[model samples]
Target: MIRSHFDEDLKQLHREIVDMGSFVETAIASAVTALKSYDVERCKEIIESDKKVDEMERKIESQCLWLIARQQPVASDLRQITTALKIITDMERIGDHASDIASLAIRITDRSFFPESEMIFEMAAAAIDMVNSAVMSYVNYDMELAKATEEKDDIVDDYFNKVKHYLADVFSTQPHRMDVAIDYLLVAKYLERIGDHAVNICEWVHFSQTGEHKSTKIF
Candidate 1:
């Protein structure tokens, strides 16, 4: 019956979701840096810190459940609560991919070899932007920002394909580096997967507003 209560609870929900997004972005950044520098120490830190992100995800999920049970949030409010639940799941999986990339960085202990970090950098940049836009869209209920994030996802996908092609060339011709090449290729794949998850969040944001996925172009 109290409107103020619903407003405050939803505000808190936004804070928790934004905080979780920040954690995912930081994990992705650290993982990319670990690969670029071949720094085992940083990679180890990434692996250790992944658990904190996991806990954050659990807390947000619990909050979403509490809100659903306590308040009969109607229509748009119901959609928002469901979207928050879905977004956290995608965010948690993205953290796992980040951890996977960090583990690959740990494999190159002795060699100074690093794959072309620029491609990873590009992917990371697009991913971060997607997260930023998606978070903002969620906070403001801005459908445009949410819709634009899908375009950035395409850019990250292109960079991922390029990295895969270059990795294939290295493995076939410079066969001596096959082991390290595989590691780098996996890192790229993980980053690409993380980007996909980010796009998924954006899709959910759009769905919460429009009631249908924007990605499904309708006639």
Candidate 2:
């Protein structure tokens, strides 16, 4: 009976993490949309939604601790809970980056000042896909999917470099738009960081499944 209860608790923890992941995915998507549209109201909404993401992280963390203290989970079970603890930290930071992007979006005075590079939008899309794949890997305990998701980080990085070059060209020719150029650069940087966090989550998923921390050297 005790084992059954503990198993059920673990299942509940999984559901909560999935819910948190869903919230973060929405935050990032909305943030990028707001950036493109110069929608301050939507940006504010993403910022406000971050609080709920944080709450979800705290709740899952509490559950993990309770399982460790009360159930004395060991081996795979302990790894699973501890991996969740680590994963949520990454997930929470992903939420923060989304909020950071939205904050930047709100500060821009000229929407037309943004560069014409399509790479920024592509970078956002890649990061969002990585986050989604990482979370799904955790939910399904699929190591192969986790590995593929980690590999996708490279695409985001490539997009980041392209955006940097594009921004540099814009800055060189249009020195008066320096501030606007820098703002867009920072947005790209945030998206790059989000991709890194997604890679971290995938690493945790790999560890949870295999009990080995996947080397990020390849990343």
Candidate 3:
């Protein structure tokens, strides 16, 4: 009976994490959309939504701790709970990056300032894809998907480099646009970090499934 109850609790925990992932994913999308549309209201909304993401992280942390203390999960079950603990931290950081991007978007008053706009949008898309796939991998316990998600980080990195090069050219020709260019650069950096966090989530997912993170075996 206790084992059955513990199984149900784990299932509930998984569901909650998936819900959190969905929330973070939406925030990333909203942040980028607000940037492109010059919608301050939408940016503000994304910032406000970050508080909920923090609260979700705390709640999930408590749930994982309770499971560890009460169920005393062993082997794969213990790895799953531990991985949940690690994954939430990455998810929370990703949320912070989303919020940071939104905050930066609000700082740039000139809508016409972003000539590297297309590259930035592409970067955001790649990061969002990583977040989605990482969360889906955790939801289904699919190691292959987790591995693939890690590979997508390269795509985000490539876009980040492209944005930097394009912005450097802008600065060389139009020194007056430096301020706006810096803000856009920061947004690209945040998206790059978001991609990094997604890869972290994938690493934890890999750990949960194989007791290995990247190439190193933990268990």
Candidate 4:
């Protein structure tokens, strides 16, 4: 009876983690949309909605701790709970990055910023996909998918480098647009960090399955 109850609690934890992932995914997507449209109102909305993500983090974290303290989970189960703890930290940071991107979008009111906006959009999409896959991997215990998602970080990184070079050239030619270019650059950097957090989640997923992260045995 106790084992059955613990299993059910694990299922609930998975559902909540997926819910948190969805919240973050929406934030990233909405921030990108706000950036594309220069919709300051939408950016503000994303900023406010980030609080829900923070709340979800705390709620899920409490559940994980309760499970650990009460269930006295064995090795595999303990790993699973600990993994949840680690992944939520990454998810919360990703949520913050999304909020940061939205805040930057509001400041980037310069119409001339559109020239390189497409790259930023693509980068954000890649990061969103990574986050989705990482969360799905945790819920489904899909190690292969987690590994594949880590590989996708390269795509986001490449976009970041390309955006950096393109903006540098633009700033060199049009010194007056320096502020706008820097803001766009920072947006790209936030998207890059989001990709990094997704990769971190995937690493934890890998550890949950194999007891290894980046090929190093953690336990």
Worst 10 residues of 4 by lDDT: 111-120
Return the TM-score for candidate 3, rounded to 2 decimals: 0.97
Q: After superposing candidate 4, which stretches have Cα over 4 Å from the reference?
A: none
Highest lDDT among the candidates is held by which one? 3
Give the number of colliding residue pairs in candidate 2. Answer: 0
Q: Pick the candidate with the highest TM-score.
A: 3
lDDT of 4 by residue, 77-187 (tens): 989899999999999999898899899988887856456577788888898899889888887889999999999999999999999999889889989889989998999
Question: Compared to the true structure, candidate 2 yields what TM-score?
Answer: 0.94
Q: Which pairs in model 3 have colliding backbones? A: none
**Whole-model alpha-carbon lDDT for candidate 1:** 0.80
Candidate 1 per-residue lDDT over residues 1-219, each given as its tens digit: 678888888889888888888887888788878777878888898898889889998888888889889887778888888888889999888888888988987885534444466776787778767777777777777878877886788887898899888878987888888898787778777777777887888888888877777556221
lDDT of each: 0.80, 0.89, 0.92, 0.90
Tell me model 3's lDDT, rounded to 2 decimals: 0.92
Q: After superposition, how far is residue 127 of candidate 3 from its true place, in Å?
A: 0.9
Candidates 1 and 3: which is better by TM-score? 3
lDDT of 2 by residue, 79-137 (tens): 88988899999999999999999999998777676646467888899999999999899
lDDT of 2 at 125: 94
Q: What is the lDDT of residue 209 in candidate 4?
A: 84
